[model samples]
Target: MSVYLFFEKKLPFREKKRKVVRWIQYVIEKEGKKSKRINIITTGDREIIKLNKKFLGRSYRTDVISFPMNGGIEIEGEIYISLDTVTENAIQWGVTTREEWRRVVIHGILHLIGYLDNNRDEQRIMKEKEDYYLERFPE
Candidate 1:
């Protein structure tokens, strides 16, 4: 199992890369999915918009976009995160940028583990899982 993180844009806060990876691993295992490989790419809004358009057929900016590479017991995927959008969302949501970044990361991981948030009920459940994992994250 492996978690790779790439930063395309200058991040506003310092990230404990190893800690984040461990947190993801824990979340995957806790959710009953064995982690195989997960790639996290942090980029700007333009890149995220392009990816969203290319993969999801939507031309817009989002905080996170997840692509499931393999479907099985093992969790494998690419999670693209838009730091620009995260920052904007943090300001609007009254949360710190780091907190918003963590939320986005956890949200992507949840998607890879078979959690869906397309509707209100699913979104609420996903949010609950995100909160559950976030609360357990080592400080």
Candidate 2:
């Protein structure tokens, strides 16, 4: 099982490759799950917007989008994150870019693990979970 990060474009900040991969693996294990692979791709608004339109049929930028590859207990998927959107969101939310990036990444990972934020209540629950994980993430 492995987590790989690809940069489709330059991001506002950089993450230590090993640290990011280890944290993701930690998140999966904490949820009592395993992964075959998780491809976390950082992209600009244009690429992500294209993906949003092509896959989700939404022609707008989004922080993160996840596509689960397998249906069994072991998780496998691709998560595309819009670095541009995430940077803007950080300013909008009054948080650091890194914080917002972590939240978005964790949000995508959670989606891969079957968490949903389709409704207001679900979004709240998801946010709480995200925060919970965020608090424990390595500093």
The number of the candidate with the highest TM-score is 1
lDDT of 2 by residue, 54-104 (tens): 999998889899999985689999999988989899999999989999999
Candidate 2 residue 26 Cα shift, in angstroms, is 0.9
What would the per-residue lDDT of candidate 1 be over residues 39-135, giving only the tens digit for each residue?
9999999999999999899989999999988877898999999999999999999999988899999999988888889899999999998888878
lDDT (Cα atoms) of all candidates against the true structure: 0.91, 0.90
Q: What does each candidate score in C-alpha RMSD?
A: 0.8, 1.0
Instruction: Per model, state how many residue pairs clash.
Output: 0, 0
Q: Give every collision pair in model 1.
A: none
| Top candidate when judged by lDDT against the true structure | 1
How high is each candidate's TM-score? Answer: 0.97, 0.95
TM-score of 2: 0.95
Runs off by more than 4 Å, candidate 2: none
Q: Which residue pairs does candidate 2 place in steric collision? A: none
CA RMSD (A), model 2: 1.0
